[model samples]
Target: MRGIVLNATLAAVKFAGGVFGNTYALIADGAESLIDILSSLLVWAGFRVAARPPDANHPFGHGKAEPLAALAVAVFIFAIAGWIAWSAIREILTPHQGPHWATLPLLAGVVAVKLWFSRRMTRASEEAGSTGLQVEALHHYSDAITSAAAFVGIGIAVWGGPGYETADDWAALLACAVILFNGVLMFNRALADVMDTAVSPEFESEVRTVALGVPGVAALDKCRVRKSGLSHLVDIQVRVDGELSVRAGHDIAHAVKDALLASAPHAISDVSVHIEPIK
Candidate 1:
């Protein structure tokens, strides 16, 4: 919500500054900010859907929505990158006057604002362990990168005068490459999550250790952990004495599940335990 509002306001301010101040780089930055508003809206909707509980139609819940949203964001970034690149190239080829001196301060302020928002989103992403939020943070950082580039490019144009008018356009072109690179990274990450990639070795090890600590569990035969949005789903096989009664084995399985859930309430959303005979 905050992101949407901020992006919209910045987009308007940047567009106005770019048009009146005669900086194509500022215009490109504004276009990126406009895209950010759309991306934030998509992320917001995805999160809402992802938070929905499981239903008869969907047994695994709606967690996939989060990654789907991230994927959409990546697509938007690619489109915007292409648009900015085309615009920058056209501006570079055309002869134009240097940007107004006032636009330099505007670019500087934009860089500061984007950096602040990037930090805030980074903290939120870490705490929530959300792919969508992480993408949002990257968007802010990318915006800051573009804004900083524009600041320097405009400074060079205004300082050197006349022949340097194309410097800001070159900077905008560079920003497009950076945006496209980030888009690829975000797409790959989101696709991995959608494909149900295995959790990290260290995280799986932690889960295995917790399961082993439960009483009656002799050893673990297998432990598989996969991420679903902000949480993890675990499947594990634990070896037990063959002599133990069926009821005892069931109890042990339940105990293991309980311990894992208790250890990381926010992380582990569900667990399935398979009890195996030691023979």
Candidate 2:
């Protein structure tokens, strides 16, 4: 919600400031900020859907929505980058006065706000266990960087004599490259989520430790994991004495499920346990 409001305000500010002050960089950044509002809304909608309980159609819940939202954000970024590059190239070829001195403070404020937003996104990503939020954090950081570049471009044009008029255009071009690079990296991560990427070794080790802690279990045959929204779906196979009856093995499997769901820090939404008898 905060991000929505802030992005909208900054978008309007940068767009108006860009036109009034003749700074191509500020205009580009502002345009990107406007699309950021749409991205934020998409993320909000995705999370609302993801929070829904599992249904017949989506037995694993709607966790994939977050990744899809991230993909949309990446596409938006790519579009913004392309537009900025084109706009900047035109401004450079035609030539124009840089941003106004009056707009410097405003641009600085935008950078500060974006840096704060970047930090906030980082915390939110960690708490929610969301790769989407991680991508957003990076996006916000890029905004700060670009905004700073705009500020410098304007400052140099104002005081560094007449030939520096093209500085703002150059800054916009650089920002475009940075935005595209960030977008590509995020695209890959979101695609991985869509593919149901596996969990880390440390998490798998934790699952094994918990499962092996069971008294009747002789060994842990295997453990696997995959992301499901903010949680993971885990699979475990446990070995036990061959003499144990089928009923006993079944009980052990149930025990393993209960233990994992209760103890896992990553919030195991579903767990499948296979009992293997040791010969």
TM values, all candidates? 0.98, 0.96
- Model 1 lDDT at residue 42: 92
lDDT of each: 0.91, 0.85
**Which candidate's TM-score is highest?**
1
TM-score computed on alpha carbons, candidate 1: 0.98
* Candidate number with greatest lDDT: 1
lDDT value for candidate 1? 0.91
Cα-based lDDT at residue 35, candidate 1: 91
Model 2, global lDDT: 0.85
Model 2 agreement with the true structure over 1-279: per-residue lDDT tens digits: 888899999999999998898787888888889888898888777777866779999988888888898899899889888888898889889856556787799998999999999999999988998878878887888788889888887888878768989887787788778888999998988888889777788888889999998878999877888887677889889999989899999999999999999996556888999999886
Give the range of the ten consecutive residues with the poorest summed lDDT in model 1: 224-233
Cα error, candidate 1, residue 189 (Å): 1.9
List clashing residue pairs in candidate 2.
Answer: none
